[model samples]
Target: MTRNIWTFITCGLLFSAAAVHAQSADIIISKGTDKTTIDASPFGASDPAGRMFIQVLTADLVRSGWFARGAQGASEYILSGSAGGGGGFVAQCRVAARGRSGTVFDRSYRGDANEVRRLAHEAADDILKALTGRDGMASARIALVGTLSGHKELYMADADGQGLVQLTGHKSVSITPSWHPDGDRLYYTSYAKGFPAIYELNLRGGSIDRVANYAGLNTGGVVSPDGRWMAMILSRDGNPELYVRRMPNGDPVRLTSTRRSAEASPTWSPDSRQIAFVSDMSGRPQVYVVGREGGQPRRLTLRGSENVSPDWGPNGLIAYSSRIGGRYQVCVLDPRSGDVKQITAPDADYEDPSWAPDSRHIAATRSIAYRSSVYLLDTLGDPPVALIDQKGDWTAPAWSPGR
Candidate 1:
C-alpha cells in the first residue's frame, strides 16, 4: 500500500453514543490553578439565567489557562454583574482590579431570554480582551467531522461546545475540514462522488462548490490568511504533493517534486508566505516548512517519530501531535527558538491538534481504544476538557479564525 493522505488511520474502533451532558451552563468545575485568579459576585442565584451566565463566563476564563475563579477577596480581579433583567438575559458586567481605582471593563450585553449561553460567550470574549489585550476564542466556532448518522459528515459548534449544529447531511464520508479566512466558509474533502474531491461550504448561505476534482488525491484544501491563494495536496501529475493556486480559478504552482515520498497536512504561516506540512521524505513521517515561492523544504521536527497535523497560530507557534510509544500526545514547537514542549500527558492517544484563535488552547482528537471525541487542551498545562459530550467518533477539528 502506498503511504499517502488516505493511508493514515485514527483507529478502526466502534462508535458509542456519549451521554448528553446538561445543556445548561450551570455546573461549576472545582479545579484550581496558579494562574491569575479572578472571582465573581453573586449574579442573583434565584434567577436561573443569572447563575448560568456566571458559570459559563467563569468556565471560559478558566479554560483559557490564564485565569482561575477564586474567593471574593482573594482574587486579583472581581467580576460583578446584574445577570438577567426582568424580561431578557442581560450582562451588565463590571471587572474591577484589586489595586486599580477604576474597573477594567464595564459593558452591557443583551440578548433573548433563552440564549443565555450565547450571551455569556460574547461577554466572556469581551472581558478577556479587555483584561489581557489578546484575542479571545470563546466567541469563535469549531468545524469537525462526526459519524452520527452512520457516515462521516460535517459538524460545527461554539468554542465551548454549545450550539452544536451539524452542517452536512451528505451521507458520505467527509474529512479534513479547513476553515476559510473569513470564518464564514469551510473547505473539506468528501467522497460523495466516489472519489476524493475538495468542496467549499459556505456557512451563511449553505452553498457548496467544487473546488478541486483532480485525477488522483484531492484533499487538504485550505485558504491562505491573506485570502489570495489556496493550498492543498494534489496528485494529478504524480504522487501526492503540495500545490498552491490563486483563488477563483487560478492555475496551480507545484511546490514539491518527490516521486517516492508523499506530502500532506499543509499549514500556512501567519504571514501567508511559508507553508508547514507533513512528509515521509526522510523515511518516517516528519514536518517540513517551505516557502510559497517554491524553495527548499527545511525539517522542523526531530524529536518525534511521526509528527503530523501541524497548525500554525497567529502567535507564530506551531502545534502538532507526536507519536510517543504506542500513543500520540499533543506538543508545541517554537520555530524561532527550536525548542519543544509536551503540553498534554503522554498516556492518552491524542492527535489532529488544531489551534484556537487565542493561541492558548487547542482542539484535538482524543481516542480511547474504541471511541474518539474532540477535546480541548490548554497549552499552559491544564487538563483536557471534552468539547463534544454527545457521541459518535468526532475527529478532524478545524478552528475558525477570530473576528
Candidate 2:
C-alpha cells in the first residue's frame, strides 16, 4: 500500500490487512485548567463487563476535561455504580458531594447485553452534566471511511471507537460521509451505481436513498445544521462549483462560478446561513466561505500555503488541515478576526478535521506514513490522542452532535 497522504480525502485509497485491537480511550483537555475530582468505582475492576464499564467511565470523565481523579478521602464527588447483570445489561449510578449528605445525582440505564459500553457511556455523560453543568459527548458516534476489508467502505463506531460496524457494504467505493440533523441517517458519496453519486443511508432502517446523481461528478453532500438545506459540490454546470439546494425538493443554487478552479468539502455554519468550503481558485487550495443564499465567495485562510477540510463548529471556530512547513497539520481559524492557530504537532500528517459537538475537541484522521487512525484533538492544547488502535486505514471522521 502506497502512502498518498495529501490526496487521500479527495481521492479514495484502499489498503490491505485487518486486526481488532482496543486502545485506552483516555483523553484529557489541558493540564493547567482546574478540574474537579470525581471517582466512580467499587463495582468490579476484575469482573468481565464491569471492568469494561469502569474503563469507559474513567475515559469519559477525564476526556471531558472538567474532572480529574482523586483519592477516596480527598475527592470532591464520589460516584458509585452497579454494572453487572445476568441477562440484559443494566447500570445504576449515584453521585454525592463531599459536604452534602444527600445524593446529587442518581440515574439508571438499561439496554441490550451487548450494549454495555454504550450504557456506561450514557451514565458517565449524564453524571458529568449533572455535576459540572457542561455538555458531555460520551455517547457521540463517529462515521468514517475505512479500508479494513481491502475495499473502501463506510464504517461507524462510538466516540471511543468501539463496536465498529460497517454501514455500507457497497463492495465498491464509498466516501465523504456527513450526518443528518437527526443523526439517524448519513449523506455520502458512493460508486455503487458505477458512478460517483450522493446517497443517504438510514442507520435504523438500512434504507439507502439517492440524493444527487448529476452527469459529471456528484460528491461532498452535507446537510445544514438546521436540516432545511444541503450544500454540495457539483460539476454539472462545468468546473466543479459549490451548489446549495432547499434539501428535499428545491432548485440547485450555484455559489461559486470559477472557470477552472475546483471546489470540494462543503461544511455548514452553526446557524446554517453561511458555508465554509475548500477552493483552489487562487492556484492553491484554501478555506473559503460563501453564503447559503448564493453570493460571492470570500477566502478565509491566509496563513497556510494549502488548507482543506473546513469543519465549522458551534463555537464559531473553523478547523482545517493546513500545510505548515511542508506538512499537513490540524489548524483552527477564528473566521471573525482572521487569526489562525495550529493545534497538532508538525511531526506527522493530519487532515480532515471534524469538530466534536462541544467544539472544545476535534475528530480527525491522523496519518503517519501508510497507517492511519482516527484521533481526537483537543482545542485547548492537550496532546493528540488516538481514539482507536484498530489496524487498517480510518479516514474522514464526521462527529455526531452529542445525543
Best by lDDT: 1
lDDT of 2: 0.81
Off by over 4 Å in 2: 1-32, 43-47
lDDT, candidate 1, at 376:
91
* lDDT per residue as tens, model 2, 6-42: 2232121111100111211122222335789976654
- lDDT by residue (tens digit), candidate 1, 78-180: 8886776577667788999987788888998888877888788888888888998878899888999999878999999989988889998889989999998
TM-scores, each model vs. reference: 0.88, 0.89
The segments of candidate 1 whose C-alpha lies over 4 angstroms from its true place after superposition are 1-33, 85-88, 99-101
Best by TM-score: 2
Worst 10 residues of 1 by lDDT: 10-19
> Which residue pairs in candidate 1 collide?
none
Error of 2 at 249 (Å): 3.4
